[model samples]
Target chain A: MIDTIGFDGDDTLWHNESLFSMTQERFRALLAHAADPDDLDRRLLDAERANLKVYGYGIKGFVLSMIESAISVTDGRVPARDLQSLIDFGKAMLEHPVELLPDIADVVEALSHRYRLILITKGDLFDQESKIARSGLAGRFDAVEIVSEKDSASYRRVLERHSVAPDRFVMVGNSVRSDILPVLAIGGHAVHIPYAITWAHEEAEPPDEHYRRIDSVLDLPPLLAAW
Target chain B: MIDTIGFDGDDTLWHNESLFSMTQERFRALLAHAADPDDLDRRLLDAERANLKVYGYGIKGFVLSMIESAISVTDGRVPARDLQSLIDFGKAMLEHPVELLPDIADVVEALSHRYRLILITKGDLFDQESKIARSGLAGRFDAVEIVSEKDSASYRRVLERHSVAPDRFVMVGNSVRSDILPVLAIGGHAVHIPYAITWAHEEAEPPDEHYRRIDSVLDLPPLLAAW
Candidate 1:
């Protein structure tokens, strides 16, 4: 029987990618005259590749890059209007609201009765805490871990802390890199949930046979029931 | 001088949260008949809190939980038409397309001229790999790591393998938990780019520091020019 459940935060329990999509759509519209969608996308990807050195991850760097990309793609000919759009986009993203995924609460409620729940996520401390408080789900977890990254060592630490043997634990999330492999590496079971739009940075290739893949979270209960 | 740059994926470089928001709106609407918006949200939050154990993280488990929540909230009284709406919503989410943030490619191209670039993300292997292939940005990264998680040790390993020092390295991404803190923990610098909507599962508070908070990726050239 599974005694401990490990979870990933972003794109799992809440709305995250849609806002990014909206910003991109606006960006594309802004650059319509300067470059085609393909060309603009290519340039922006190049900028992200370059900026990763100076900016680690988060919206601040992304907005900056968007501005830089606009300027570069426009050959420094970016209109003041476009620049304002970029700034406005950044501000909008910063102030965007938080929303949870469907049925997360009820399903969690059902599972909580039988298992030890832990929230394993990696992000800014204040931002994350605020979201949890806003989510109003902070009280349900037995422990909440805010780490720099999720990997074998992080999993080991979590499992050890919970006194759970690898076999008795499960890791679930949308990304293969963070959710499945590390746990599998340490002999833990993992389930993969594919999202419609995955971020380029979060991209990973999955291996066959070490873990299970489900199309939606709804399938989990039946799968776990079988297990 | 910086020779190589690594990036954290997920919320950093694309539109991610909008889909969740749409689903959330749908969820709230669906439950509006049975409960108030605030109460429904509270219930969903409660379910998410509970499921963190059995499901962990990702859309599959979330989608499942959402279905469960719908069933429970409506006491299995949801109309057949509404059931179709729920199914359609999930289908739409699964079929949702992927798009990059504005100017992302442009910034990478500019930066690639002066530094080696790599992509480091954590998630399921197949999911990440598929995204990378579809993204068409794969060629830009010198190395792409779809890691299981990110932590100080993992960062150390990446740095060691690349023969780089923490001081000279910069990690960028939307996740402070995965991107900023670990780099700082290992003596590397990180830039935080806050996103509009962060996934509750990936949520973590920010550290108390000035160097840690950044307004945008565009701010990097100025900051790093001096560094």
Candidate 2:
């Protein structure tokens, strides 16, 4: 039996990437003069990749990269109001509501009694803590870890914290790279719940059959029961 | 004997408030026309107080509060470039070097084998984790927790995680509000290493006389040795 179940906060349980998408559209318009929408998008991704080490992931880093991209892409011709607008977009994203994906609440409620449920997310500490506080699912989680990145070492640490080995720990998340691959590599069980939108950085070709894949978190309960 | 030692990261182990001091000077110059430096400082503190529940601590929230303070103080007349400058100041603060406070490194190194050390700091997760990673102190800590806030409950949780009660736990830090009082309230031993500069928000009266105080963290090892 699975002793603990780990959930990814953004996109898996709630609408996260969609907010990033909405803000990216605003960004494309803000820099329309600097480059075409497609070109601007590519450049922004490039900036994010380069700044990842310096800023890490989350809204603060994202906002910084947006500013850097805006200034560099426009050759420093971007208006001050436009700079403020980029900051505003990030502020709006941080303040955005945590919209739970269909049946997530129900699944969490149903699963709480049977398994130890924890939130293992990576991002800006403040943003993730704020989101978790506002997510209204706070009291339900047994543990919450806001980490810098999701990797093999992170999974191993999580397993140690939960006091369970790979076979006894299961993960449920939206990203193949973060939620599934690393957990499987550690010999833990994983389930992929497909989100409507995934961050480009989180996308990876699905690993060969060690874990289950379902249409939604809504279907997670029955699938776990069968296992 | 103290079985576990908890160290507050920012101002205690490394230079933190001084960076804020430097940034505040810049903020004052940027908004000099809006209000006097004293007035701006007061308003920013007010903004930080109001947004504490929303943004928490660390550079990101500090920067947001600074922006809000600027807009309100200037009657919305603050220049967009000035606003960008505020964001830039925060970015610079996060990127600031972790300058070790006088004898912190030696104290930690001396006490590592004798105590179960954990770095219990509250702030933006990425920034704190990155600082700890770069500070060359990670090897000394058995555990590192980047919390959203520090309170009686937080201290209690930390003790529980370390599998100890109040008498067996000891904490050392710079802030009366965050580092000292909370630990004392929970019946744990505390040491206050007074930093010359402190954020207005973290200012508070010394609560009773149960804990000890020293001029520098360098004094910590001898103090711990006696206790």
Candidate 3:
């Protein structure tokens, strides 16, 4: 039986990738004078992938990458006003309200009563804290950890700190790379609930037949009930 | 006697503010034709102050603010190449090597043998982790905490999570606002080693007589010995 459960904060609990998608649309339009939408999208993705090491993850990095890509694609011809608009885009995203996934609140509420819930998210500490506070779901989780990366080592570290054995812990999230395989590698159960939108960087190969899969977090309680 | 000790990461343990100072100098020189040095500095500070809420703290936010300030100061006439330079400045800072303060390594080593050492820093989680790992002092600390803010409540929460009592804990750092005041307010001991450079936002009134003050971490050993 799972005594402790971990939840991914971004797409799992609330709308996150949609914000990036919408902003990417704005970003592409802003630079349309210099590059086509397809070209701009490819360039932006390249910048993000290249910058993930130095900038890590979050809206701040995304904005910086956008500016970098705009300059490179435009051959340093991107206007300063356009750059300013990019910065404004980042601010708007940071201030955007948190929107919960379908029935996630009720799912989390029901699960909280049965297991020790931890909000394990990987991103900018300040941004993640802001979202958790605004989500109105902060009180449900026993602990919230905003980490730089979600990997086997990080998962092990967090689990050890929380005095949770891998055997008794289960992770639930959207990204297979971050939420599923790492936990499974560490001997913990993982519940895969794929979101409609997935960032390219977060994409991973399918996990072996070891972990459970669900259509939505709404289906989580019943799945666990059977366990 | 202090059984557990916490150390702040940035200026207390390494050279941090100097980086910002150097970058600000370059920024002013780059925008010399647009605004006077004094005016540019003031504008940049204002932008940073205004952006703290949305952007939080880190090189990423600082870069965004610099771009904002550059555009505002230049009245949107700042060249695209210059804006690209600003983005490059941030990437350079993020990749810059960690420079430890005078004898901080030795000081941490000495204290680690006697007390449980915790490196409690407030900043971007990824940046802080990189600095800590690069500082070669991560192994010396029993635990590390990268938090969003350092206040009384944050201090209390950290202490409770570590199973530490306030009376037996002591926090050592450079910033009076972040490292000293909040720890004292939480009923714990604090040792203040003032850094040469202080950010305007971090400036707080003189802390009360309850806390200990030292000129450097070099002086920390003797001060703790007498206590």
lDDT of 2 by residue, A1-227 (tens): 77788999998878888888899999998787779998888888998898777678887677777877787776666665576677678778888888988888888988898888989998887788788889889888999987888998998997787687788888898888889998998898899887887555655555655598888787777777777
- As for candidate 3, its clashing pairs are none
- Tens digits of per-residue lDDT, candidate 1, B109-193, equal 7777777777887643334544566667788887676554577887887777567877778787777878888888888877777
lDDT computed for candidate 3: 0.90
Candidate 1, residue A198: CA error in Å?
4.6
Order of all candidates by DockQ, from best down to worst? 3, 2, 1
Write down the worst ten-residue block by lDDT for model 2 chain B: B198-207
lDDT measured at residue B197 in model 2 versus the true structure, 0 to 100: 74
- Give the 10-residue window scoring lowest on summed lDDT in candidate 3 chain B: B201-210
Model 1 alpha-carbon drift over 4 Å, by segment: A198-210, B1-227
Model 2 lDDT tens row, B68-112: 788778766666567768777987888877898877788799889
Query: Residue A162: error of model 1 in Å?
Result: 3.9
**Strongest candidate by TM-score:** 3
- Scanning candidate 1 chain B in windows of ten residues, the lowest lDDT window is B52-61
If you assessed candidate 1 against the hidden native complex, which CAPRI class would it receive?
incorrect
DockQ scores of the candidates: 0.02, 0.42, 0.85
Off by over 4 Å in 3: A198-210, B199-209
Instruction: For residues A1-227, write the lDDT of model 1, one tens digit per residue.
Output: 77777777777777777877889889999999989998888888788777553343455446656766877787766654455466558557656666877767776667777778888876433345556667766777776766546789878977875678999888878888888888999988888886778766765555744478877777777777777
